[model samples]
Target: MYLSSVSRPASADPPTPGRPGRRFALVSGNVVALGTVSLITDVSAEMVAAVLPLYLVLGLQLSPVAFGVLDGVHAGATALLRVVGGFVADRFRRRKLVAGVGYALSAVAKLGLLLAGRSVPVIGAVIAVDRLGKGVRTAPRDALITLSTPPESLGRAFGVHRAMDSFGAFLGPLAALAVLLAVGQSYDAVFVTSFCIAALAVVILVLFVRERPEGGPPDTPDGPKVSVREALGLLRDRPARRLVLAAALLGLATIGDGFVYLLLQRREDLGLRWFPLLAVGTSLAYLVLAAPLGVLADRVGRLPVVIGGYLALGATYLLLSGPVHGWPVLALTLALYGGFYAATDGVLIALAGPVLPARVRTTGIALVQSGQAMAYLVSSVLFGLAWQLWGPENAVRAAAVAVAVVLLGTVPLLASPSRLVTRKVPR
Candidate 1:
């Protein structure tokens, strides 16, 4: 259905011959606003994301294969939107406006989950809307983050932004866990809470965040210099190429946490409530590590940070595949999983911005994100099918093997930013 639409301010039509960069809130303001929304949204999302597999499997009796099919379809649904998001962001040049719409779409996704009936496919469709919002917003959002910051400190800016963004991730699941404790463990409570948070994110973004006037530097050598084809063509650089390739491979091998939770549930050994709590452990670890890891990336290099994240995540997949049983194993694995997300997700976005123009920055992020989501789409389906065909450990093992292979292949190509990507200045 339709969300309450927001009208965006006019595109930066050459900034009217010298409208000063008005010492606005873009850098700090945008980050803070985005963080607030993220925190609220995460409170909603983590509630759902944390226990979605349980909803699919035990609550609905869907097989691992069916879950995979659903996950794949959900991820792929988002894939349809990135090109549109990028093209729209570039064409209308209304990055902030497009972003507002994205947040609303994500918020609505949670509502869909609550309405979903007993049918497995309906649930998948609900998840699909949720993820499509992710696809749409991601590019435009990153593009705005880039627009908000000073050129030299893009890494630091994005990192701090990431750290703040992840704070919500930490709280969201805890809120859900609280819901489970207080309101009783039903899907409706989590879904409605998540939807509320998503709506709150929209309100915060709309009111507090502002756009830089048009003809903004790097976005324009004079004015939006690059064509869509040229923007897409920039990925031809070796580092961009490697990063996307590595991202795609990682995506192919990687399984979402939802699938992992299902595996835990499928074993029939753990308490029903344990999964969300374990998810809390994961989100908390991610929140704790996000800032520190982001700082480490700024100090050492994004490549090292990113590579380490991949290795750690690959190992986590291996661990989940192994005989480590009970809450202890689950707890540690969840923590590492969060750490993996904390380390890589933002840093990669940081890495991406400098490599692309302000105009096309979102598109670049969209492209890689789209790739990863595509991998998720493919991996979930394949992984679920394998789990059904063989078993959970075997399915996980197969994913781990793919991860290990890609990691070894990409490590040699890693390089520092000065060499890897070209830096741009707002003209």
Candidate 2:
């Protein structure tokens, strides 16, 4: 229903006095506060994520098929709820409250796992609950960031936020490992510690984060009050609609990260002992590059950066099927994979920030995210089936091809209609 005022970088309003060159200062305090919340929450969440598979498959001796189904549920069960959460937040104008509820739900779910004992169904439910919290909080939390920062610096703001988030992800497994060693590998100890950490995150959110008022004075109207219908109607806008579809299409071409690591192990015939290190390498790369990439996206252009990230992903797929051997392949592929994440993860949302109205921002973002998540679910299944039917090499090459085609198609869909979309593509 609305368009960003500028189609190119030069037309953008100059940064407010004392703002443009000041990266951290230009970023809103809300972003840093949320980033801290994410860092702590991710550590708690990741601590469990790092150990849950081992506890389920090895300790409980569940079949691979059962684990696969549970894994898919864990990853995808929250997709639709994301829209619900976003809509609720916008409708009530209570984003912080909605996000807080999500955080509390996740914190409590950590304790639920401890009570679930060895029961498979109970454990599955607990995991689902935890994921639901993640889904619910994500859109509102990101919406807060967009509301807090200037539109021009959205990329850099998201970058710093993601960097902090990635840092937590990097620390999570390590924290789990330390807890395990400290408590003789007791899963209950890890769960309790995770709950404590998550609870602390909730406390930080309540104490530090401030919510925008429901409506301002007569002289200053906050955009129209958002309704569920208006939120959904965001799709009526051409640019927004294209962004949603393009995100889903791009996501369809992406198989999950685990598959990439597994392929690397299979290709190199790497030892079981080194399997975990593959993830570590990728995380290292992501942590190192996320912030810089964000700044680059802000400076260069978000669309090009996003496309470049996907290109990095396609290249990673190609390298997996390439003739390269030994450590070089491992290092290069992992770096490219990390680059892919750095480029697209937050950048995509940052790209979407200006396209949709502030009134329905959370809902619009949730729509884009839900599409990607659903497509990712289908993509993972399709890739697995392809691997079985055509073998890993063929399956991977097909993925690379799909990524190339999607990238080409997406460029035009995302292009601004006014002109050649120079330094900053239109919102």
Candidate 3:
């Protein structure tokens, strides 16, 4: 089978409230139910990771570049896994099983962290392996999400999924803050708790979640076999080809979300770690706005959401690199930051899904995510280098500038998402 332009199959775990048949019947609809499971899991993870850099720097005595190096390895591993996992999902028809395995592995990694000694390399290796499973699981799980949600309601379905994911994101940091406050910012305790939460997420997947539009056996599904030539040919298709190109451009331009946290870290250096209370503020904002934004994009246009969102994000970063810091400033920045995530993430995923040939949906999603992973490697490395040379705040300013340039350059693409979006599928 060939690697065609990748498609996003619907995987970002969020609580999808039952969409009334106003659009299409919800498939597993339990996709939203599973969002809760993910939320619980993330709460466990965020607490540790939110302050993980501090652990590395304060506890491990690493440098900013080391932080970047770790980030690159994590993203790089996850990114490459997406390419391989997509093919497996498409080939074996075992999307759900793979997803289950991925979650189990991630949970195990978290558990391993609890047992490991003060060996930084060992812990880092475990995190990388755990992320390897994430790479394996994400495409198939997303494919399942897309497969489960009917075509017409794709935007809402993904929106719900992202919201759930974001909610988990919110809880993770908040939980971390609580742990730090209670136990004096102990990374080990954070790791132990996160392991338990991850365990719960895996349990829910095994017990409750089922793959939708269920395909073939784990060995192989009965679809047009994808040859490498066929995969390559997906790029030659008109809009599918164009959509993938646009995806690559965005991927190249958009910097790592980790940078945003780094920006928060800088604020901490500026005497504002207490300012991450603003992260909570941002999560709340995402909670309020994400679904509505999803519904809005469905009614208006995906381009408006994406292009406008990018512009807003650029402005948010610019403002962040401005005189912003402390409680008031951090709150404002994170509010827009979370909004930036809410506005763009689901819309981009929704836009990509409809444009590609259905047969290569798994790979199409993989391609976009892979492109993102590659970009993370580039941007994160650049950001890290800049941070080490110039310091965190200035490097962030550079990233914001780069984003503005990309946002402006990509404006032309948003003008005609209709051209890229495929004709409506049969009801």
Candidate 4:
């Protein structure tokens, strides 16, 4: 099978193969360290994310429009920063340091929530700060994973990392609930505890993660430092550009998970108490399937696996339209939803990794991610409007149609090496 363009430094050895005596010997040590950090950090971030909407909407009593604006900000405000963080990390060859800075910024923002209290503007600002840190850290962290692992095992490595990340997501809300129960429903205590956990994640990053060695071939003059212009020029490559476009297109069709669960709840007349459990179900599926699906992608191919994921998503939207109902539909939809994330989330980045030059891998990944985030913000707004005008069922049906169109287009765009490849230049 033809391989994608995986540009690793000549000096850096390929990732080690699985060993009989060593557990997880197939995966690199860096991936494990990063995954551990992500697991702890996600526990902290998800704790706040699970409750921030309630704190803003019910606690502060913001209007729907105002809350929607905050949500949009939470989703898309980091678009530019993602590019900046990626570019800076690539330029300085300090992926771990940049990632750590982002992690630190997020850890500190947990405390900012305490100071914000019930003030709407303050809360919005704090949320934006937290998202900004996520924006900054994500690309650099993903890039580190790509650079540190072998191309052949990229899917498995990312799968393992995302599974760990999803495991944290599954636990975060439970952790918050436990804190609330213990502390007599004190949000402040939750915030404080979250900050402490996040700080520990930062410590893990500092002590364990190592930056990959930089510099290309010995003969290459370390290719001029990656500048902003070069970073922007990343899309000039055909496959890279197509990948970005496809990601955005798919993202535009996808609505937020909250909306999906709300529809199911309304259809089933589910109790308010059980609403949060919907997310837990999906996270559980994701945690279970991420690693296995990733390994499947490595053994088979990433493109087909990614397409299968969106197909699962389309099925989810269709399921919401009520051809099927009750617990069976809910269970199937949640499983598909989880499968969608397992297939696409890390796999998309892994697909992008080999197609990009190592020098600007972070920037390229950030570009793809930012495009999708911006599209998702737009999609959320559009879906909300569609729901208001045409009702939830029709809106979801339309979304299913959109996903179908994009998924079909993406299949060919990323089908083979020749299509994605344009020209390889000395970096």
Best by lDDT: 4
How far residue 242's Cα lies from its native spot in candidate 4, in Å, is 1.5
Query: Against the hidden reference, what TM-scores do the models get?
Result: 0.85, 0.85, 0.84, 0.87
**Candidate 3 regions off by >4 Å?**
1-28, 115-120, 213-224, 268-278, 324-326, 413-427
Kindly list the per-residue Cα lDDT of model 4 for residues 93-196, writing each as its tens digit.
88888899889989999999899878888887887888888889999999888876766668888999999999988887778777877877588998999999
Best by TM-score, which number? 4
**Candidate 2, 1-427: lDDT as tens digits:** 1122213223222323544444446466778899999999988987887677667766898754466456656766688999899999888778899999999999999999999999999998998899789888988998888777766677878888988887887787788878777878688998999999999999999998868621110111255676667877878866678878888888788877656876787889876444546666776788888888887777777777888899999999999988888898889999999889888999889888766666677898888888787777777767767776788889899999989998987877777565323345232
* lDDT (C-alpha, whole model) for all candidates: 0.69, 0.78, 0.66, 0.78
User: Tens digits of per-residue lDDT for model 3 on 46-139?
Assistant: 6656766656665677776766767766666578678777777666666778777777787788777766666778767887877777777776
Q: Give the TM-score of candidate 4.
A: 0.87
lDDT of 1: 0.69
Instruction: In angstroms, give how far residue 50 of model 3 lies from its true place.
Output: 1.3
- True lDDT of residue 384, candidate 4: 70
Per-residue alpha-carbon lDDT of candidate 1 for residues 199-277, written as tens digits (9 for 90 to 100): 9788988888766633233355356444768666747755556656666766776777788666656553777777776
At residue 415, what lDDT does model 3 achieve?
45
Better of 1 and 4 by TM-score: 4
- Model 4 clashes, total count: 0
Looking at candidate 2, the ten consecutive residues that score lowest on lDDT are 213-222
